[model samples]
Target: MKEFDIIVCGATGYTGQLACEHLARSYGSELRWAMAGRDMAKLRSIQARFEVPSHVQLIEVDITDAAAAASLAERARTILSTAGPFANVGEPLVAACAHNGTDYVDVSGDAVWIRKMLDRYQEVAAGSGARLIFTCGFDSVPSDLGVFFLQELARERFGAPAKTVKGRIRRLVGGLSGGTLASGRASIQAAGADPKIPQLLANPFALVPGFDGPAQPVGNAPVFDPDVKSWVAPFILAGMNAKSVHLSNALLGWSYGKDFTYDEMIMLPGAEDADSAREAADANIWSNVVRALQIDLKPGEGPSEAELAAGSFEMIFVGRTASGQEISTTVTGEGDPYALTPRIVAECAVCLTQDGTTATGGVWTAAAALGEPLRRRLEQRAGMSFSVA
Candidate 1:
C-alpha cells in the first residue's frame, strides 16, 4: 500500500505552492497527499502558511538522488511535479516512477526532454504500468485535449474523423512564468550547444518515433486565415502543443487519420489587420517570447498573485471532416494561464490516482491516458469549461 495518494514534488516553487494551496483548501484531511521539495525549511513554511493538514506529509525529495526518488515513487500512488526546466532535474524522478508503477504528471513544455524520456523509459513505463502524462498544464492539455474533444465531436457529427484541426488562441491574457522562461532559455542554450538537438526540436513529429506525417502548415509566419477570417500571429508554444497532439493521434491508433494535419496561432481580427499590422503584431509577440527566454529570473520568482489572477486564455479548435463537415469547440479558463495550471495539474494527479484510469504504461498524452474522465474533472473542479462553438 502506498503511504500517500499523491506527492507534489517541488511544492515550494511559485506554481507548486498554488497546488499545495488547492489541495489544502479543496481536499484538506480527506486526501492523503504530501508536500515535497529539496528544502524542508521551505516546505515547512508552506505548511505553516497554508495550514496544511497535520496528516499531510512533508517530505524532502532531491530528484538527483536516485535512492530518494525511488523511495518517494514507491510511497506515492501519484506524483505531480511543478519543477522545471525538467530537462535538468526530471530524469531521476521519472525513471523511478516508471520503474515502480507510480503514475506521474508534470506541466512540462520541453518536447526535447520528453523525447528523451520516451526513448529511454517508454518501454520501462509500459512494462511497469506507469502512466506518465506530460504537459498536463496549459501548454498542451488545452491543445492536445482540445483536438481530442473536437475529433470525437467530428466522429459523432460527421460519421468520420477530422482530417485536420486548427487550434486558435482566441484570447490570451497572462504573463509567462519565470520557470517557463527558464525552461525556454535552457532549451535554447542546449539546442545551440548541440547540433543535433535543433533538428529534433524543429521536427513537427518530435514526440512520436518511427513515423513522420505529411508536411505541416508553416505556422511560423503570420497569415490571413479565411476560415477564421483573421490575421493570425504565430503562437510561440505551438511547436510543443502540436507535437503532443500528434503523439495522441499516434497513441490512439491513428484515429485522427495518418495524414492528419494540425496547426495553431493567435488570432487578430481582420478588421484592421493588414500586412503592415501583421508584421508589427508578429514582432511584438515574438519579441516578448524572445525576451522572456533570454532574461534570467530566479526559480521561485514570477508575477504577483494579482498578475496571475489577471491572466486568462481561450482556445478555439475547428475540426474538418473528410466529408467537409466542420465542428468547433472552445476551451476557456480564467486567471492567467499559469495561474490556472496548478488546478489542471492537481486534478490530473488526483485523476490518475482514482479508480478508473491507467490503461497501460508508457509516456502518454492527456487525450490518450485520461480522456473524458479528465475532461469531466477539469470542468467540475478546475474552473475550465468545454463547449461546442
Candidate 2:
C-alpha cells in the first residue's frame, strides 16, 4: 500500500506548487501527502523549497503513462491535479483514478471536459470508490458554493429555496495563470477540431439535468432591481459557474430547485460609481489581449508578491424565493484571484483528503464534496467568507 494520504499531481506546475507550499506550511507534519509529476527534478525542487518531513514522498508519473498513473493512483487516497487545459490531459488521470479507487480534484474550469468525463467515468468512479470533483478553484467556488449558500440563506429566511439566484462579481482585481490560459486555448482548439464541440460547450444543460434551454452569451446585460442593493453587469464567470451549481443541484436531486436560474454580473458598490463599474467592464480587456497573443503568466511567473498582496475580489449573490422574499450574501477573498485560487484549491484538496466529512465513491463538485464545510473552511482558513447582507 502507498504511504501518503494524498497526491498533489502536477505539483511542479504553478497552482500545484502553491498547493504543495500550503500543505507544507500548514499541514506538512500532520497530513501524509506527496508531490507528483512527470519531472522528477522539478518535483524534487518543489519538495526542496519546503522543509517537509522526509516521509513525504515524491512520485514520478505522467498522465499519459497509464501504468505509472495507476501506480500513482494506488499510492494515494486522493489526487489534486493542477494540470491545465485539462481537456487534453485530464481524462487520463481521471480515468486512472476511477480505475484505482482514488479520490480526485482539479482546478479545471472546463465544463465541457467535465461533462464528458462524468458521462464516461462517473460509474467507474462510483464502482471504484473514487470521488471525483472538478472546478475546485476560484472559477466555480464563489459561484458553485456561493449559490449553495444563497439557497440555504433563502430557505432560512423565506422558508423555501430561491427561484432565481444572481451572482455578480462586485469588485475584483486579479491575474490569470498560463495554465488557465492554456486550457482556454486548448478548449478553443478542441472546439475547432470538432465542430460539434462548440455546441457542446454552449449546452446549458450539458451537465445539468433537464436544462434544455438555449445557451446565453456571458456578460450580455446590465441592470438593477430590488433583490440586491446595486446595479448588475454581465457576469463573465456566470457561464461556467451556473452550469457547475446547476449540475450539483441536479446530482443532489433538486436541493436548489428545478426552476433554479443563475446569472452572474458585476456589482456596483452603491449605484453611484458608473466609472468604477465601467472600469470593471474593461477589466478583462488585457486578459483578452494576452489570450490573443498567447501570452501567459506561467508557474513562478505571476504578478509580484507586492501585486498579489494588493489584489482582492468581492462577489455578491442575490436570491429571490418563490414566496418573493429575498436574501443576499457576499464572498470576498483578498490577494490576486489567480494566486488565491490555488490556495483555495489546495485547501479544498486538504479538506477532501483530511476533513473526513464528504460523501464517498462518486463524482462530485465543490458544492457536493465540501459544501458547508468548504464555506466555513474558506471563511476560517482561506481568507474567504460568506454572510447575509
Candidate 3:
C-alpha cells in the first residue's frame, strides 16, 4: 500500500493551497495526505496560513525532476495537481502517475492538453491501473456531472437516455484569477508555436480520439433557444465542456447513444427581447475579455474572499429523447466557481481513493470514472447541490 492516500502536488501555489486547506479542514485526521511542492518554506507558510492540521505531512516534490516525480507517485494512492498551464508543467508528474499506477486528477480545462495526455498515456495508464481524471474543476465538472445527473434521471424515468442535451450557464458568477489568465495565455502561446493546436482545439470531438458523432448544433451565435425559453450567448468554455461531456459519453460505452448531440451556452440575465439578448451576449463576451485583460492580478492571486463569497451559480442541463421526452437537472453552487473548484478536485481524488468506483485502469473524465459517488460527495460535502427538475 502507498504511504499516503493522496498528495496535493502543487500545494504551495494559489489553487493548490486551497486544495490543501479543503482536505485539511474537511477530512483532517481521517485522510492520509501530504502537501507537496519544491519550496518547503512556502508549504510551511501555507500550512500556517490556513491553520492546517498538524498531522498532515509536508513533502518537497519538484515535478521537473523526472526521478523525483516518479518517487512522489510511488508514495500515493492518488495525486491532485493544482498546477496550471498544465500543458507546460503537468506532463512529467502525469507520466509518473500513469507509470506508477497512482490515480491522478487536476484542475485543468484545456482540451488540447487533455487530448495530448490521452494520446500519450492512455495505454500506459490502462496497463498500470492508473486513472488520470482531468478537468475536475469549474471548467467542466458542473457540465459533465450535470449531464450525468440528467441522463441518470432519464434512465430511471424515461427508460432511455437523452439523444439531445443542452447545458446552459445560468449564472457563472465568479472573479477571474491570475492563474486562469496565465493558463489562457499559455494556450495562446502554444497555439502560436504549433499551428496544429488551433486546429485540434477547434474540433468539437478533439478529446475523443477516433470517433465523430453527428454534427452538433451551432453555438457561436446569439440566439433564443426554444428548449429552455431563454436567449443564450456563447460560453467561452462551452466547447471544452462539450468535449468533456462527449468524452464521457464515449467512455461510458456510448450509453448516451451513438447519435447523442450536446451543446452549451450562457443565458443572459434579463434579456427579454431578441435584439437585447444579442446585445447582451456581445457585451458579455467583451466584458469577460476586458476584465481578463485589465485585471491587475498575477499568478497565485485571485479575487478577494468577499468577491468569492459574493459569487454563486446555477447550471441547467436539459436532456431530450427522440420522441420529445425531456428531463432536466440543475447544478447549483452556493459559492464562487473558483472557491468550489478546489473542493471538487479534492473530492475527485478522495472519491478515487475511498469511494467504491467500478472504473479501472484508464484515463477518465470526472463524470465517467467517479460518477454518482462523486456526485454524492460534491452534493454532500462540496457545497453544491444537484436537483432533478
Candidate 1 lDDT by residue in tens digits, 297-359: 677777688988887889889888887888889999988877788988998888888746646
Evaluate model 1: give its TM-score: 0.96
Candidate 2 residue lDDT tens string, 91-168: 888999999888888888887788889889988988988889888888888788888888877777778998877777
lDDT of 1: 0.86
Q: Which ranking of candidates, highest lDDT first?
A: 3, 1, 2
Predictions in order: lDDT: 0.86, 0.76, 0.87
lDDT for 62 (candidate 2): 78
**Against the true structure, candidate 2 has what lDDT?**
0.76
Residue 70, candidate 1: alpha-carbon lDDT? 95
For model 3, how does the per-residue alpha-carbon lDDT over 272-387 read when each residue is reduced to its tens digit?
A: 98788877876673234444556666989987888778889888888889888988889999788888999999999999999868888888999999999999999888899999
Model 3: clashing residue pairs?
none
Supply candidate 2's per-residue lDDT for 221: 47
Each candidate structure's TM-score, on Cα atoms with residue i matched to residue i, is: 0.96, 0.90, 0.96
Worst 10 residues of 1 by lDDT: 279-288
